[model samples]
Target chain A: MNSKSKIIPWHSRFDLQGITFLFFLLLCLGSFPALEGSGRDLDYWNNLKGFALKLFPPDFSILRSTLQGIWETIQIASLSTLLASVFSLFLSLGAARTISPLWVVSITRMLLNIIRTIPSLLWAILAVVLVGSNPLAGIIALTFYSTGYLAKFFSEAFESADLKAQHALRGLGADQFQAFQYGLWPNLRPIIWSHCLWMFEYNVRSASIIGYVGAGGIGLHLKLYAESADSWNKFSLVLLCMLIIVTVLDLTGERVRKSIRDRLEGKSSLIKKGD
Target chain B: MRVKNLGICVEGKWLIRNLNFTVRQGEFLAVRGSSGSGKTTLLRVLSGSITPDEGTIEKENLNSNECAMIFQDLQLADGATAITNALSGCLGRNSFLSSFLGFTAQEKKQAIKLLNLLGLSDKLNQWTSTLSRGERQRLAIVRSLFSRPRILLADEPTSSLDEKWAKVSLELIKKDVEGRNGSVICSLHDSHQARDFSNRELFIDSNSPENWSIQDVESKKS
Candidate 1:
């Protein structure tokens, strides 16, 4: 048969070129103000250098108080993370589409979205207004923020799990809870542990900043030192302590996450051998 | 057990309609059908996994907990050991807390015995994912038997087995049924196997007005 169709050019075959053009256009428009603001005089750099010189040989007289503040921050973060994990575990069952009914899943997800829409800083501010300047406020704020974040993550993990085992267990007359315990829990345990650890690490970072709202941590001290302008060395010391705490947390989190991943890999490799 | 005018509709389309059948104690019923003809649906309805849109099933002396199904996909927990998968069959009959605590010593002994009987003694503690297709099918049979069900519903139980393993699997199921004075309803594609292995046969067709028909194949065997 003779062909009557005309060939189309490569550029016309897909919208990739058009999409890339639009992306670059948007990037240029978005960066215009930032590019304009970035042009600064040499005086600005000299002032920054002066400020940097003042931060060295930090004041060691407030070391004990700084350590205490660090301990309070750790307490706020760990306690909030633990409470949030429990809250998220309860909510995820209702939020996961695979297990919950349509209305329950939709309602729970909507509530979680609303909770997550508000930033942790906003929650910290609100809690400080309601509960006064205390570690309790910081713990409450972080707990609320983490519950929303962890619920979304936990529900997604539960939803992606295979449902065949659950169906088989149900067919055998096991109730829904029993089926979840026997069929779904084994598949989800490792992921749940990983997500909780991730949330704990995140809370540690948030807890440090939440204290800026007078929630009782190193951030309050940092704010005080920075506001005074003469205590730049103490501020530097607090910053250093914050960096050290975050680094230690990140390392510990990485080690725990890696161990979990290794165990999961080992179990999966055993399963793969059967395949 | 008797099913009267049973009908099942999936996603607003009638899959099986107005079906009637009876399975006597110690009898094996073979259901024969082509692909997508709702053979699995019928077995699922009998096992009470899905509610029929019409009609009722009357199973005397059999609660839902007393029924076991051997799924065609061999729905074994891949992360668990063979013994754990087998032990799950007992979950229906045991108390919830007890089952969560895991199998009792006597239950474990019985599970091991059943596994040994199915030529899976060597793979007792192995992960189910590592089992061969035939081994997994045999393991499913072993799991089903561990429940000591009064009504066993097997969906294409031998579809993945060799002729030798298929026959052995069928024999094991038959022996379990006879020992418990229970009944079995199995779906199979092979007519020869259906005629040879079962005492009665039921044919289902999606296009047929009657939906299903039955024959006394055992009388022909005699």
Candidate 2:
């Protein structure tokens, strides 16, 4: 299309879209030469092969202890998720711009953003410094990180809920808490359950990793396996155990999320519609 | 409830100016106005959702819990069950914990009875989103009446209803207001409806300088 025909192409190929494509293309090539250096050393390849070879013959001896650690990780995720759910619900309530004061919403949202900006692993290390390498450390780190995400999710959910319903509730003299309870909470209930379940599953994975820093989980066992002489077999076994557990949780979470949807759609509610 | 010198302006244009009205106990005050005449805005201000630029409502120191508005759009919680939506009317009297746990057994029974009365017995468990427009309108009526408000401010409530349901719903409103010795300020497009059910008629004309006026209507003319 020519400019005179009313299809104005802003300088053809070097326009904004083309410039953006070119910029991305250059960035795409940025990692090429550095990535090429990764396979340059033959010795490193041999060591990797050797490392792979050592992770064989499942170590059944530590299976019981590994299961115990797995249980601890589950506990850590559950506790932190419970705490985070309560904290985030209230925070999100206050963060709802349509109800709460602007200054309060801004401060709470900025605080949540700052919390989310820090990685969970770094939070674990920080907690280890504060609480000194225990399950409590894992709980604290995951709670802080999960609160950040859940608050953001819940606030957006609250904002998107039926505004007219909220106004009606307020018009009837329901206070902020009551308004949230009746107005937004019913719609958000299913979503909150789904979000919390997903977060719990995620925290379980993070719990295992944070244990490497002595925060208490199966990852601590993996760390010890690395420190000891050629215990890569046990390390691989621990990873296999985590894989099984995470897979089970992921599948179960899917079913749970499905059930929540069914319930919300009125298949079977507490106040059953007789369906 | 008495509205005194009420005026509301939007976008530097006066929608209502120096409006005055009084609603006595057990009175059904029908508000008549053409489209975009600030009738809804007047009700919104009465319901305390929109603060007027100027004026005051003397509700004898009555708070919002004692007043309810049936919105033009209904504003029922669409994602919730019909029963849940009906029970929401109790939010004014019940605690947040009670609402969270669910309303009291009596509230549930009353809600069920009202739902049945409105021919919504089978829809108790249905989501509000699935209900037809007329059913939802009746549901909004149930919710408003469940609160037992001293003053019910309905804005074109029967717009979506069939002629039959419209009469049934309006009759319910009239019965509820008179039973409690309360008052209703309802807006309507049909002068026949305004005269049939209400004891007073109020016309708000936003385009003119003298925006609002009220006169008495014969009670139960139909």
Candidate 3:
């Protein structure tokens, strides 16, 4: 009987306008008929299936050449990553804001930015034009690219490191390099290894595409096979080789990173036991 | 060491203004101040870590290398072994090449002996992070001794220790410097303890007209 005096007010509005706006957006997108490619059709799917089926039996004739290409690619990536990491290590000291002078930090940062503005693929193209079509071109391109990337990463690492120890070392009259070696290096060792491994993994992947620009690697073989419509079997074999190499590299990188961490932790714990 | 018209300003605020004092050789001068009275700043300036805004400091036989400071925070590298951290004090005295190659056999032996004297013999290879706070403070003292400093600037070196340990730490520092005819200028919050440990005391008051003045506690007591 008391509820009879009460009235419910509906203050919430329906979202009809928002729903309509979304619907209109979808309708406008669907109206662009020219954007639809043949790949969306049944015939395209059937053709792709047949082509994939034909790749089941790969040609073993080019196995030797494929293996050689894989090895060359590995060499290019590994050497480039190694050299880049070292150069970046030195540059990052100047890039770190807390550790370096203002002018040095600004200049190093500008240089890194300029280098990173160019993509690795474009860098490879530039290297090819300058150095000719060789593994050296690929390596040089990767080195330049990796240097910018690793320098930025390392500067961030240095910035994140604790500066109390560095300050103390400086108070003890240590130069910048010595202070970094005794104070910051130990804290940054694990991070440096992780970043290097990640860069190596990235280099390995990018090494494949760099070969398309005539910087020697397995992508050169892939390009040749791609040009011939019936050479899907060879293309598939090359793809398979790339898959195996990438998987192996990923596994190796993980193992190495883990081992480094374990070794550092083990040494720490061993010292703790002495107490 | 003589300081004349020494002034230190941090970010436009004068922490120490026109401070003048002389620390004689073989003198144990205790600096007493309340919190935020610039005791640590004065020690830093004395140790040449911070350049004073005005005036100059003249040392009779001490170079920058001949002075070592035990920071209030005890800045030991946590990732390093206790021995390694202790050995870093020698870096200032050694040539760059020798420091790069690491401690020599004799240097290592000396570091071990210092650590042992501080009762940290069992923790020679221990990571500094794993050591207790008292142990870390002891390690800091040992590290400062490695340089055989002619003048030692200690900023609250015994703050983290109990009464017994504080006395031990102060005694150890006193013994080391007395034997070498060196001097120690340490900051202490406890005035009584300062009087007990040091022959002379320097009092700093940020709010007082005389910002700093020295008193011979022994003379006053006598």
Candidate 4:
């Protein structure tokens, strides 16, 4: 028998699109009357257009305040990621199936999943309610969120390491933790560091928005400007600043990731050469 | 070392049953058989990687520090260099933190000394991925001996080697085991090689011995 010619089962019954169409039709019937009397005249763009028009020719005089807000946002993001990375490193060990007992792994993974279910914005709001409107609240919320996300990936990296090295180490009378230190960590270090660098970039943007929930940062200032009608020009100026800040963050993150990869793969560092 | 009433089963088929054996200090015991004659399986069971279905392995006067195994595949970590992999045998002696930070000066010196004896001193820092099959096989033996275990169990140590390398490997193995006051139990598909190094040999046939005896008795002309 030619392996390539092996016959598979040929019956193709239903498709997903048919089921999706029925579900969508039911939703249309249920919410049909709610969309009535809300025509093109009541569209979002028509209502938001006048306010948006007043936002152009941004006030450059607010540069100092916007720069201060950007610095505060960067500080919050960097500190949160640092704290979260540390927490995830320890939690991931308990969550790793090879290193941890079954019950411990189960409990840690469950707790992490629950933590992840609470979105960053919700955690920020909860932090504000408990700790008052401060950048500390945003930092705490983002740190917890990043910890939950990073721990999952870290455990997965630990689990995917070669079992032969582990087995050999175990045979040498090394304990579980010893085997992990020698056998798994060396293999997983680069991948884990790369993921952490990527997560730092993600947290930077998320930190910007947490301020909108009254946790003070760039978004807090943005919200204040939007609230006062006279300061609409400052809103555009702050938006432009945010764009520049985000772009710089993105470029810095890219360079950091490349540098890590280059070092791990034994490549010559281009930026290091330039410096 | 002695194995009493040793048996092995895989997927409901018995590979070996009621097989008893012993290996003594300073002895080279060869288990000779054709391919698929339960030779490797018996070696694995002896090595403690594969547990027999029924057996009691009693190591006479064996200390925890006196057992080492060289696998057929060499089992060296490909990501590490030859010296690094060899030094891993001393991992039991070092603290976990020291091993993770790489070998100490003493460990490195010991690894180099062993690799020098194995005629692999020049290849000490060569990555395992770049090693030839025979080089890897020798490295594997060196790795096992680096721990200075009393009993060295090798599964087809010379099977992948050329004639010259094969003889060199077997001679090194005998010399190392004898030097350490250790013993060796090796399985071989080639009886010639087994006869050269080992003082004693055991043969395993796949057919039923009882049925063979019965047929011989019935077919006698006398």
> Considering every candidate listed, which one attains the maximal DockQ?
2
True contacts kept of each: 0.29, 0.46, 0.28, 0.09
Cα lDDT for residue B209, candidate 4: 17
Candidate that scores best on lDDT: 2
What is the lDDT, from 0 to 100, of the residue A83 in candidate 2? Answer: 100
For residues B123-187, write the lDDT of model 1, one tens digit per residue. 87776666788888888888788878888999999998889888888988998877889998999
DockQ of each: 0.25, 0.35, 0.23, 0.12
Summing lDDT over every window of 10 consecutive residues in candidate 4 chain B, give the lowest-scoring window.
Answer: B209-218
Give candidates' CA RMSD values in order: 5.1, 4.2, 6.7, 7.3
Instruction: Judge candidate 3 at residue B148 and give its lDDT.
Output: 81
Give residue B220's lDDT in candidate 1 (0 to 100). 75
Question: Residue by residue across B151-189, what tens digits does model 3's lDDT show?
Answer: 999999998888887887898899898679999999998
Worst 10 residues of 1 chain B by lDDT: B123-132
Q: Supply candidate 2's per-residue lDDT for A195.
A: 93
Docking category of candidate 4:
incorrect
Q: Model 1: runs farther than 4 Å from truth?
A: A1-24, A27-31, A38-40, A43-71, A94-107, A157-161, A217-275, B3-21, B50-56, B76-84, B100-103, B116-139, B161-168, B189-197, B201-222
Error of 4 at B44 (Å): 2.9
Off by over 4 Å in 2: A1-21, A38-63, A90-110, A159-161, A224-236, A254-275, B3-8, B14-21, B51-57, B60-63, B78-80, B94-102, B125-132, B190-195, B204-222
lDDT of 1 at A209: 88
Error of 3 at B212 (Å): 4.7
